[model samples]
Target: MIVAVTYRYTEDVALRDEVRPAHRDFLRGLADAGSLLLSGPFGPAAPAGALLLFRADDQAQVQAWVDADPFGTRGVVASATVTEWDPVLGTLLPAL
Candidate 1:
């Protein structure tokens, strides 16, 4: 199943400055493992929330993934919400 993992940074500027590299590396590892589908920040002018799409079997797996994030470990992410996602139409869909 696909899951949407959303999180907001506690200290936007500090978190970005301090953990950006580690965060990128962590996402890269997830991509390499075929778990991360898409991920990015809310943009420079926006709040420090991020959205991550993941293909995983269950919420436990999603939680585990989030728990291992450098951002999470460093307290950059204040909280996260993991929700089951059903892609009705988008680039995420397979060619019919």
Candidate 2:
């Protein structure tokens, strides 16, 4: 299953900057494990948030990952929404 997580950052820019390296490292570990498909922060023109796509066995597993994120652990994330995603046609992801 594919799980999509959206993270809205807090207003604390300094904290977010401080925690970003650790956050990226954590996500890199997930990607190395073949769970994180893709992830990126929203463009500067957009909102202050990020989108993460994960290939997981279930949403619960994705939730666990989200719970362990540095952003969440360090209080850099203001809010997060996790949802199951289905990709019918996408070159980046394998065909369903």
Query: Using TM-score as the measure, which candidate wins?
Result: 2
Candidate lDDT scores, in order, read: 0.87, 0.93
Instruction: Count backbone clashes in candidate 2.
Output: 0
Q: Superposing all C-alpha atoms, what RMSD in Å does each candidate have to the true structure?
A: 2.0, 1.3
Residues 1-96 of candidate 2: C-alpha lDDT, one tens digit per residue: 999999999889999999999999999999999999889999998879999999999999999999999999999999999999988776775532
Which stretches in model 1 have alpha-carbon errors above 4 Å?
Answer: none
List TM-scores for all candidates, in order: 0.89, 0.94
Q: Pick out the ten consecutive residues of candidate 2 with the lowest summed lDDT.
A: 87-96
Query: So what's the TM-score on candidate 2?
Result: 0.94
**lDDT by residue (tens digit), candidate 1, 9-95:** 887677667888998998999989988988988887987789999989897899998999999998888889999988889774882
lDDT of 1 at 28: 97
Q: Model 1 shows how many backbone clashes?
A: 0
